[model samples]
Target: MTKIKTHLSLAVAISGLAATPAMAQDTWEGMDTNSVRGEVQQRYDAALAATQDPAYISANDPRYIWASEAKAQCGIALGYLKSRTRDEVSLSKCRMAYDRMMDVPRPRPVIAATPPPAPVCNRELPGLIFFEFDSATPGPDAAEIVSYVTENAGPCNWSSFQVVGHTDRSGSNAYNLELSQRRADAVANLMTSRGIPQSALDTTASGEESPRVPTADGVRELQNRRVEILVNN
Candidate 1:
């Protein structure tokens, strides 16, 4: 029966999860005057401490049954010690119970580090540059908007840019087409002057077509005569 109990105790301790004893009881340091009592007391304290380890605390399947067996063995060992009986078998069993619990691996905890926030660009994009009637210039007001885009371009991740020019329905279709190209060129030049890369600029003209305000032919609409800065970041 004792051999069967020992095998069962070992099986539970092995099946449950035993590890390098997490935190041993301090009583291991203080030994009793009698050799048998001191040994039993030491092994008892150690076996109990093994069950309290972090790895076994949450997963207590093996700890409870094995700890009960260890306690019973320790109790028998203690009884033999009190009677001054030289029962080497009981003492050996107590040692085996304690040693069985000292063998499993524990999983350590891991901590994660927090990452920093990314940079953000608050400037408005797809900048509009309106031209005066019959002229290609974007007017002085375009300077502030261009400056904003130029300075914030890097932060805003602006890679490619398109300067699309448009004309109001006033001149002949051929004349308006030529005028729109000139207007697009003028805005592209202005952007390049403001430090925008020339290689990144693309110009397109839509003359007297796709008007913003939708005006009839020969009408001069202020909204239609403009170039737009389209950012493709």
Candidate 2:
């Protein structure tokens, strides 16, 4: 239960910021009044299991860090839910943390055969890596996600990659565009350092134009602050 910085959730103090009904609903996914605690508890159980999972523990999987973080955040939310007054903000943070872990699977190391055939997989491999608001530098999960993308690229025989960056509508249009591009470059640069050719990457910045979860012009929706790595063979 180490205080791992849960990026977007804690990047800004939002005690005074009350989320609108629409925004909260979208952000919470299915954490409604009826089953909020039940749903969160389910993810908490899964996160707890991940911490001790040999697939992660034995091989030092990077995702284990996220799982551990999710467990802590979710645990906090569960505690708050038990109190007389529920903290909506904390619950939102917990849900977002759990969402990050939802798609990621346990690490499975591949052992190459002596004379294996050309690497290929009949499937698509895409990645969405979030960032702290207003910052171009990658966050804690950057390296881990980059590694995941690169590992899958080999099997997909990737011909090209789309590295598009986005930002929550918190700043001016002009400034946001620049920030988004910088974020794209940050992720693209990681790929280049990992040996993914620059020419093969098509980078673009959506700024506040394309948000995962739309909000007001000045809203700081954590889910909108992300870079999507789209892969194609």
Candidate 3:
């Protein structure tokens, strides 16, 4: 009986050892870490090449915006690994080499910064008029503006339009800025009430500083208290 028990234990141990290779194969079949590392290196090289030439940088700039965030993640992984395996002296040398490479700056591509196209007023006159002196409530003149927009503005092509409200130089700059943003929200709400989709409009505010007409410091210009519309063309 003792001999039989010992043989049974030996058999179970042998069976487990036999299954180990199959389990390892199953785990490694679909996931090749070395292959993934090679592919990541290829992408990093390509991104580095793009950053070299001005034209390529303009067409495919990885510094300003990532071509693939995954590739940048791979770079971070490589940097971390490099920092780990080396001795302290070697690690410091590697860091200095990386810093020197990064310090070499490249010139930006020469592209004309053209102004955006003018807003298509389309004879609609403006809509959603803003109020002056910390008031969001639209007055009687606002009705005319709303009517013109409803009657004449053509089919909305863009997904969103912006309503930017401004305030005259009156109160604290910060307070006026917040007030201006509220005014913009009020105008956007007005537009939503007139059968336009609320999802298609956004609001922003520029306080006393960004005035339509330049004024002396602390001058409360009524003309500066207005709202402008911008369409995503």
Candidate 4:
């Protein structure tokens, strides 16, 4: 009889993270752990189907085992983050598990099968809108960009729209953070008003930490002060 190996359990990986009891249970509170686990099980099955190798689409294939485990953990980690339980330790463990799984050698294909075309998802709009110093108002070009997003997002049935704001390094860190957040909010508000649902939008401020170009402390860079829009389906 052939000995079958099972993928490492997510609980075992979580235990290795050395999570504090409070941190681990924070998001699980007020929720039925059994029910959530069942939901995750369904997602795991779907992911396995999505990642299964065409040549060996069976439960015994080590490739399917590896892909499903990595995907399940990654999905769980994202769920925790989305639930407002963001922790570096949990995220690091998930990433490591995925990397280690992908590092393994996959079986050579005995039969050639043309893989299905990848799904069309995620779009980065052309031409970012540069912002004036300390201003949240959209200029003429910025308005055009915003219009494109508004017209396309709902029709595309996008799952989420990310508005990331950045700023030049001319101001204090505190000031830049606030300015960047305001700019992101301005863009998000415009999109929501134009028909995009508020629930589908996320706003983040990068401040001076993520400049388009490296510059001195007091330098004003035009490209750095901008908002990036990403649509993910």
- Across residues 56-89, which tens digit of lDDT does each residue of candidate 3 receive? 2233212322322222233433433333321222
Of candidate 4, the 10-residue stretch with the lowest lDDT total is 1-10
Which 10 consecutive residues of model 3 have the lowest summed lDDT?
Answer: 60-69
Which lDDT tens digits does candidate 4 get at residues 80-164? 5445444444444444445455565655654666555332222534225567657877544556556656655554566687888
lDDT of 1 by residue, 125-156 (tens): 34666676789877554675577567657766
Error of 1 at 178 (Å): 0.9
Candidate lDDT (C-alpha), each: 0.64, 0.66, 0.49, 0.59
| Candidate 2 segments whose C-alpha is farther than 4 A from its true place | 1-125
Q: Per-residue CA lDDT of candidate 2, range 1-233, in tens?
A: 12223322332222133446643554545455547677778987887777555554333223555565566556655655555234565566556556666656655556754344333222332556677667888765568667757765867677689899999999999999889899999999999999899998989999999986669899876667788888755
The all-Cα superposition gives candidate 3 an RMSD in Å to the true structure of 26.1
Q: Candidate 4 regions off by >4 Å?
A: 1-122, 125-127
Model 4, position 42, has a per-residue lDDT of: 53
- Top candidate on lDDT is 2
Q: Write down the lDDT that model 1 would get.
A: 0.64
Q: Is candidate 3 or candidate 4 better by lDDT?
A: 4
| Number of clashes recorded per candidate | 2, 0, 0, 0
- Model 1 residue 161 distance off true place after TM-score fit, in angstroms: 0.3
lDDT of 4 at 118: 30
Give the clashing pairs for model 2: none
Please give the distance, in angstroms, between residue 20's alpha carbon in candidate 1 and its true position after superposition.
Answer: 82
RMSD of every prediction = 35.8, 12.0, 26.1, 17.0
Model 1 residue 52 distance off true place after TM-score fit, in angstroms:
65
Candidate 1 clashing pairs? Answer: 18-104, 19-104
